[model samples]
Target: MIELSRVPDQEMWSISFGGDCANVAIYCARLGLETHFMSATGQDPYSASMRAFLTAEGVCDDLLLVHHDRLPGLYAIQTDASGERTFTYWRDSSAARGFHEVEGSAQALQNASEADVFYLSGITLSLFDRNYRAQIAELARSVRARGGHVAFDGNYRARGWADPAAAREAVASMAGHCSIALPTFDDERALHGDTHEDQAIRRWHDAGVDLVVLKVGAEGAVVSSKDGTAERVPIAQPRDAYDTTGAGDSFNAGFLSAYLAGATALEAAAAGNRLAGEVVMHPGAIIPAEAMPV
Candidate 1:
């Protein structure tokens, strides 16, 4: 999508390519992973520019299918007083919504399954129809069944779901298939009303997640594994954060980068916090490439 983040008070807009999965793909590529993105794009100026942006960031765009009828998707972010954001999307009739309906969609999904890590989110599921969601679910399960890591984030947004029931179903499916599950406490509370954090944790574990990390803003992340081990990891050094957009996406990328490099789960969570902290210190979905930690 063509991302336009409104600069509060200044009435300025910073335009770029943005989306949760795309953000993760960029961060993963920068963190030394071979990440390929699969989606549909319209043959429009915005799509052209977004593709160029992805290429510039070293994320592969060969998997994108071109659509002639629909235009590209666009979203604008409105940041609040506390660096939180409210998003409004023009994606309902977007070309990318039919990504899995394209002829090459299954081939793309099957090809991506060979990856060492298969990463996706609830948003990805929400974008597609029932059949496509099934394809995604099956792909994730296949990845895990083959001993590959399937990383999932229930980056739930009620607005994206057709209804709360659909959200529950998709999120539950991903939770059941992921090897590493990353979820926010607020999202869990909104979706399931789990009184205690452990309730959410237990739910994911029971659903088949071998490792789960519950992100509690400021309080840091609580990490748990199927072996009954759990602990809280503090955030990395705080920064003068300005925007919280893409913080979770970057955290997942950083954590995956560290974890793929053989770090312990707790160490990976620390890595996630470190990157997430850095991400919030900047505006928009992506920080300036020069500002990224080495």
Candidate 2:
């Protein structure tokens, strides 16, 4: 959501290294976690710049994929005078689509299996081929099998999936494999056509996830655990939003940052609200490092 696209009258232009996983990985690195980003980039100057930017953000480069023939994806944030944004993207033939290249596949998969917690999104899944998707899913299952957490976000972009049903099926299958599921209520409603937030939560719970965070935009969010416990935590304050692109992504980052540090679901959701609230006040998916709270 924080990437680049050409639009009239949005005159303010800036470049930031962004993606759902990148935003979360940046947040994790800033939060003092050992973070690794698994994705491919082009051999172009833009990709070189992206590598430098991510390094400066504290993300380890060891698993970051590099490809000679492709280019990084791009997106545009079309904002009204009021700062509300709608996006148009150009990622269809990007290098990210070939993410499971063997150069680092085994190592990256091993890292996923060994991480205390592994995070990914629907866009992340869309990058892989069908076989690669299965491979990634198996790595997530391996992480959980070893008593680690596997967190998933159903950040479905209609433009990314071949069809709504395919997105639903892929996301649903991935949900069944996750230990913690974080999904935006609107995305869930659109994808699964589940009328109520509870039904969406139930779908994941029934699939065996131990915890779920249902992000309901302005109404706040619901945090549910396997024991049938559900807690509604309100947003800390309302806002005249600057950008909503990565609100949910950063929310997951903050929530997982606290959770991995031993916070309760409610406490983590509160952390999520606090972070997302701040992110929407900024102009992009990623805010300045100095602006972050320690």
Candidate 3:
């Protein structure tokens, strides 16, 4: 997706590449992970630019398929004084909608099955129909069966689903296959009517997720494991947060980088908070690589 963002009272927008999973892949690559991103894009200039951007970021674009009939999605963002954002999208006919149906997708799936870790978000599930979503779930299951970690983020957007029930069903199905569940408290509240963070944590645990990190915005996350232990990891909010975009995506990257290197879950959450803090200090989903924390 091409993102156009404008700050409060601004007339001009800054164009950049941004999609939930794409942001994670870029950050993970920058964090020294060998990341591969799989998605469908158009044969347009923006699509070409996106592929270049991914390659430059050290993310493998071998699985990115080009669709001849559709264009990539476009979204515009507007941020308020608090750095919170609102988005308007033009994605009904995006090439990514053809992700599962595209040519070479089978080969891509076979390659993805060999990964050590598989990660996706609710937004990824929403792009496909029931059958395609099942395929995704099967892919996650296969990864887990091979002793790989399956990470999931329920990044729910109400507009992305046909209804609340549909969103709930899809998220629940995907949750069952995830080993590491990274769900935002607010999204859980919206999708599952979870009044408390514990409700969200318990739900994921019930779905057999091994680790659940419930992100609570500035207050940080609640780290829980299947062993029945839970802890609150707190973080200081960045005072100069210019935009809140990609906070969770960057957090995922940082957490995964640490956790995969054998950091404890609590330590990974701190790493996640550190990177997320840095991201909000900048303007877009991705900041300059030099701006990253060492």
Best by TM-score: 3
Which portions of model 3 miss their true places by more than 4 Å?
7-10
TM-score of each: 0.96, 0.94, 0.97
Candidate that beats the other on TM-score, 1 or 2, i.e. the better one: 1
Off by over 4 Å in 1: none
Model 1 over residues 128-225: C-alpha lDDT tens digits? 87767888888988888888999888988998987989999878766777899989888899889888999999999999899998988776799999
Residues 1-294, model 3: lDDT tens digits: 999987445677888899899999999999989999989999989999989989999999988988888999998876778888678889988999987778899889888988999999999998999998998898899999999999999999999999999999999999889999999999999998889998999999999999999889988889999997889989855456778889999999999999998899999999999999999888878989999998
Candidate 2 residue pairs in clash (backbone atoms < 3 Å): 4-75
What tens-digit string does per-residue lDDT give for candidate 2 at 219-280? 67899988877889998787777678788988899999999898988998988888888888
284 Cα displacement, candidate 3 (Å): 1.6
lDDT values of the candidates?
Answer: 0.86, 0.83, 0.91
| lDDT: the better of candidates 1 and 3 | 3
A best-first ranking of the candidates according to their lDDT comes to 3, 1, 2
After TM-score superposition, the amount by which residue 105's alpha carbon in candidate 2 deviates from its true location, in angstroms, is 2.0
| Per-prediction CA RMSD (Å) | 1.4, 2.0, 1.2
What is the Cα-based lDDT of residue 118 in candidate 2?
86
lDDT of 1 at 151: 89
